[model samples]
Target: MSKNLVEVRGLKKYFPLGDGNILKAVDDVSFTIREGETFGLVGESGCGKTTVGRTITRLYTATDGQILFDGKDVTHLNKKDSKALAKDMQMIFQDPYASLDPRMTVEMIISEGMKIHKMYSEEETRNRVYELLELVGLNKEHATRYPHEFSGGQRQRVGIARALAVNPRFIVCDEPISALDVSVQAQVVNLLKKLQKEKHLSYLFIAHDLSLVKYLSDRIGVMYMGSLVEVTEAEELYKNPLHPYTRALLSAIPVADPKEENERHRIVLSGEPSNPINTLAECKFYSRCPHKAECCKAGLPALREVKKGHFLACSNADALYVDNQGFL
Candidate 1:
């Protein structure tokens, strides 16, 4: 087995409101991404998936918990070490247009990281910029153009090129294809897969699209409210989802075949997601879970392995099984 390139343990990022309330954007989340593997994080909007990615890249400081990168304790890196960490870790933002500076040329945007890290000389940086652009499917001539000149797909290619500039070992892909057209989304996903194979890069991919996540991820983690509810291999997750939220999510993925799609039962979950502000120690999905038992209300279940290579946080698996038989 490949060694873990990144390990996040009990990670938490809480935002303080003006009042006494505290919003737990990420609460006690933990996972590991092996070298050259893609770990996909999926959930509904406002589920703290984005916050986990940002915190891992150090764009946002953590409220508590530890982050280890390549066996180094990176949770509290000094200035010098932090600068070194920048070269090893990188992020691709969701908004391709907003992430790239309008005033800068494509060449400038792609070579910025290399120049900051002093990775190459000026001539080398320029040559590397052209190479990266080509690697991401853009040509050398486009380097002189500004962000406004490119289409959404082209702009996203530029963003991908920029992320690759430093030759990072790991990247946080924060919904890199969410804003693109359906045709373009596949192209970007393929590009990422191609790059990962060529460069041996690990990814922490965060997205709401479950089908896309399954296609690209080696393993998957399902998040809800502020915590991870289930984690397992990508295929195993779709084949056997133990958590109620996971079942609901998988059931909602649109089937490609019209006949099958029409025939399949959809698990329509009711009620809004629970508020994250100072929530009590109880199952957050209690409001919408059809399998909820009195035991679920006692305290928040800690994520533990239920079977080989599968981890779950739900305590009422029997109840889930009972409901699965006829609840759909």
Candidate 2:
């Protein structure tokens, strides 16, 4: 079995909205990413996908639970340890334009991490920056220009170079390609895959696009409200989705064959998601799940293995099935 590079156990992040109200962003989520593998996370907007990434990278202090990086608990590291930990973990933000500083040139942006970590001499750092520029499909000439001078895809490349400067083992990619043009997204994703193979890196790739996630992930986890409803191998997830929410999500994907597309039936979820503030001890997706039972409202369902290597959190998984007519 491959060793897990990162392990998140019962992770929770709650933001205080003031007026004695707390917004439950990530609640009791757990998963493991193996070394050199990509673990994809998918959900609708405001479903706490980004929050999970931020909390795991220690950008936001987790409200509860444990985060273990290479067998070391880092949920609350000290200043010295946190600084040292930076060399092994990094993040690629969703918005390239907003993440990069307009005033700084690409060279400066990429070398800042090296300078902070005191990795190499000035001459060596400059040479490394040039190498990284070339590695990400940009020339050394582009390094002298500011972020505004590059296109959206080029800016994202620069972001990738910056993350690679310190030679990280794991990265949290928070929708890194969502802001780019449809044509450019594939190029960026291909570059990331190449880099992962070359560097033996692990990634927690968060995105709302299910097709893209399926293409890049070794395993996929589906989130609803603030909790994970299903997790399994990428191919297994598409072939056999047990949770009602997972079935609904997969039903929305468009097929290429005209005949199949016309015959497909979409599962329309009724009612808005329940509020996340001070939520009760009940299933978060109970209101919207098509196969919801009275027992679902009694308490929260624990994630359990429903089949070999496939985990699900639902009280009525046994009764749910997909037939020729559709989900029933």
Candidate 3:
């Protein structure tokens, strides 16, 4: 079996509002991404998916919990060690245009990480930048152009190249394709898949798009109100989702066939997602879950394996599963 490349245990990140309140962006989330596997994280906007990615990548420090990257504790690494760790893990930000420095050329942007890490000589770095540009579907000639000169998709390609320039083993892709046009989204996803296969890279793929997440992920994790409520293999998640949130999310995906689309019942979740500030010890999804019971409000349910490899955090998961029958 492939070893876990990243292990996040009880990871929590909270921001103080200074009025005796805290925004719990990520609260007690735990999961593992195996070497060379894509672990998809899906949820609605403001659900802490991006915060999870950023915290794992060390862009934001964890308020609590452990982050083990390739067996090393990254939650409190020294500056030198942290700088060294950068070569092993990199992030592809959600917004390509905002992530890239507008003043810098593509070549410079791609080479910056390598220069910081001292991966190669000046001559080799230039060659590596050219190679990276081509690797991400951009040509060597395009490397000299500024970010403003390219379209959104092309700029994202540049962003991908910059992340790859460091030759990292793991990447946190923070909704990398969300901002691109629909026509270009698939192309970027394909490129990412191709690169993953060729480079043997592990990805923490975060997005709100269920269809895309299902397509590219080896395993899928459903997050709601800053907590992971369900996690299982990609196929298992679609085939037998136990959590109400997961089922609701899957139901929202539009079927391409008209007949199937018309026949399917959409599970529209009621109420906005629960507030994450100083959350109570109840199911984070309690307000939105149709299967809510008195037991659900007793306390926060611990994530437990209901079946082999399928984990759920609902108090009445088994009951919900039985009740759903053919629906889920």
Candidate 4:
């Protein structure tokens, strides 16, 4: 196995909800991304997939935990250290339209990171900026244009170009294609994969798209209510997801084969998700778990590998119960 480029241990983040209540946005999340590989984080909305990405990139400081980059601790870096760290990691936000500064031209936007880091002279920065545009499938002429002048796909490509300006080793891709049309999503994803192979960059790709994750990722991590419920290779996750939440999530993905789509059953989760602000030291899915037992309510399950390289939180993978009888 390749050495881990980034390893997170017991990562936690919380937001105050007033009156002694706290929103546990991210709780005790842990994972590792090997160098030159993409690690996909998949889950439903508000499950802290985005938070995990942001925290990894240090956009949001952790309340408690350790984030080690290449065996060096990075939880609390001073200004200089943070700036130095920025060169090694970058982030591509969910909304392309919102991520860019409207006031700046495409050239300015792409070179902004280089300017802050004092990486290049004026001419060198300008030359490199245009080079990035072409590398991302745009033209030198487009560099003079504004962000609003481009289509959604084009904008995303620009966002990617900007992210690459600093020559980062890791990128926190926070649902980079969620805002684009179906036709454009594949193009963006393919471009990312191509770049990864060429640049040998590692990624913490955060999204809810299981099919897409399986398509692009080497390994997959499943999160539920701010906690990672399962981690395994991409094929293993699709074939034998262990946790109840992961199995249910995998079951929900629509299969392409008409026969399979028609015959396959969808796992419909009952009850509501736990509140992020509540005291949820126990299992967050306890309220909706079909196979919930006495021990499950007492405490949340810890992640343990049932098979080699296939880690899961739920103790009983073979005994998974589902209430979606007629639906499946």
Candidate 5:
């Protein structure tokens, strides 16, 4: 059997804005999640990171594509089949406050999924909820309280517990640490890493935090607008980024050490994001690329491999590395 827990191919999601206009939110994206690894998806806001997670969960159907889960093509399952598919896959949403139900207590929040799936009896449900609450660093007492009673970080732990309640094999961590304090962010990340190890869970971890991605991801994929421009082993991506957009994003990560910060310079990118409607077939970063060329504005470049595992989507991936004088 293939080692991949999830496989996505030619995924496309588009929205019509009326009058012959369309917004290509997620266009022609493809990736894979191995059985127990975190496949990090990083991009700026409005770049369809959230849309990818939602599309995978079938919250929004793809305009065209394939979603393979555990070797099955569950891409277009109907409501009945989809509900069954959800048993093995779950998602932890980005916004803890907004994602939680205001009227429900924490116990109801976590147990509702188990009840819908008919996974437990009423007595067993409460016990499962208690176990999950403790697993996510929350106590049994917190289960009786409303979402408003906890801090942002606590509410997110509750969300994590809810996702785990179903005992899913695959989980989409949609920026689960983004809305928390810096200290708490690491805690949440560590919790995820621990949970993955203990449960043998596979994750499609989406985030814009470069530092966190470097820490938690086995492989990293960089997205610009709605397209993946580069994907490589996490350390290799930070060390030898191939795409200009990836270079720019990596350069933007702040260094904690002053000496290291002084040694390496940051790349400064200009120009606004391209129109998602994709009126032109050019490379999306061409408008702001430091090493722009006339050829880049004509057609979209297909992803190419410079090495065994590194994939880059740029016509000028190599050209930007060296100076004009040809010195490395």
Candidate 6:
């Protein structure tokens, strides 16, 4: 098995509402991203998927728990240490347009990391910027242009180049393709795959699109209201989703075959969503889970392995209790 490049244990990120309330962004989330593997995190908006990625890359200070990167505890690093850590870990923001500074040209944006870490001299940095531009499918001529000159897809490629500038081993892809057009999404995804294979990079790919996640991820983690409900190998997750939220998420993916689409049963969840503000120590999906029982309110269901390599968090222990035509 490949060694883990990133290990997040019992990670928590809470934001204060200033009214004696706390917004539990990430609550005790734990997972690992192996070297050269893509760990996809899929969830509805406000489920804390982005926060988890940010916390892992040290963009956000973790409220609690440990973040281990390459066997070192990086949960809380000082400014100097954090700057050093940046070369090993980086992030590709969701919005390519907003992520890049309009005042700077593409060359400046891509070479910023190299300059920050003083990884190379000015001449070497310029050559590296041109090299990275070509690596990301852009030309050397475009280096002088600003971000606004390119389309969404082109700008995203620039973002990818920027992330790779420092030769990071692990990257947090915070919905990198969500803002792009449908036609261009595939191009960006393919570029990422190529880069991963060439560089042996690990990724924590956070997204709301289950289909895209399925296509790109080695393992998939389903998050619900600041907690992971199901985790398994990509194909295995689609083949057998143990958690109710996972099933619902899988069912929501539109099918290409009209017959299969028509016949497939959709798991429409009922009931109000659980409040994230200082939530009780219980299942977050309890409010909207169709398979939820009275026993679900007893206590928080910790994420535990049900079968080999397949983990789930549900109070209902009956593994055979699959619904909606065995989740189609």
Measured on C-alpha atoms, candidate 1 has an lDDT of: 0.92
lDDT of 1 at 99: 97
Q: All candidates: CA RMSD in angstroms? A: 2.0, 2.2, 1.5, 3.1, 2.2, 1.9
Per residue, candidate 4 scores C-alpha lDDT tens digits across 1-328 of: 7899999999999988778888888989888999998999999889998988888889899998999999999999999999999999999988988998988999999999999999999999999998999889999999989999999999999999999999999999999999999999989998999999999999998889998988889999999888888999999888766677887888878888999899887888886677777776557788877677766765677787767898888744435522222112
TM-scores, one per candidate:
0.97, 0.96, 0.97, 0.95, 0.95, 0.96
| Tens-digit per-residue lDDT, 1-328, candidate 1 | 9999999999999999979889999999999999999999999999999999999999889999999999888988789999999999999989998999999999999999999999999999999999999999999999999999999999999998998999999999999999999999999999999999999999999999999999999999999988999999999888888889999999988888999999998998997797888587668998898878989997668888877898989878756653454333
Q: Model 3, range 168-217, lDDT digits (tens) per residue?
A: 99999999999999999999999999999999999999999998999999
lDDT ranking, best first:
1, 2, 3, 6, 4, 5
lDDT of 6 by residue, 130-186 (tens): 999999999999999999999999999999999999999999999999999999999
The clash count for each model shown is: 0, 0, 0, 1, 0, 0
Residue-level lDDT tens digits of model 5 in 238-289: 8777677787887888889999999987897887688877666677887888
lDDT of 4 at 130: 86
lDDT of all predictions: 0.92, 0.91, 0.90, 0.88, 0.87, 0.90
- Model 2 C-alpha lDDT per residue in residues 1-328, reported as the tens digit of each score: 7899999999999999978899999989999999999999999888899999999989999999999999999999999999999899999999999999999999999999999999999999999999999999999999899999989999999999999999999999999999999899999999999999999999999999898999999999999878998999999888877788878788877877899998989898897778888577768887787877878887668789877788988876665552232333
Q: Stretches of candidate 1 above 4 Å error? A: 322-328
So what's the TM-score on candidate 3? 0.97
Of models 2 and 4, which has the larger lDDT? 2
Query: What range of 10 consecutive residues in model 2 has the weakest lDDT sum?
Result: 319-328
Off by over 4 Å in 2: 256-258, 321-328
Between candidates 2 and 4, the TM-score winner: 2
Worst 10 residues of 1 by lDDT: 319-328
**Which is better, 3 or 4, measured by lDDT?**
3
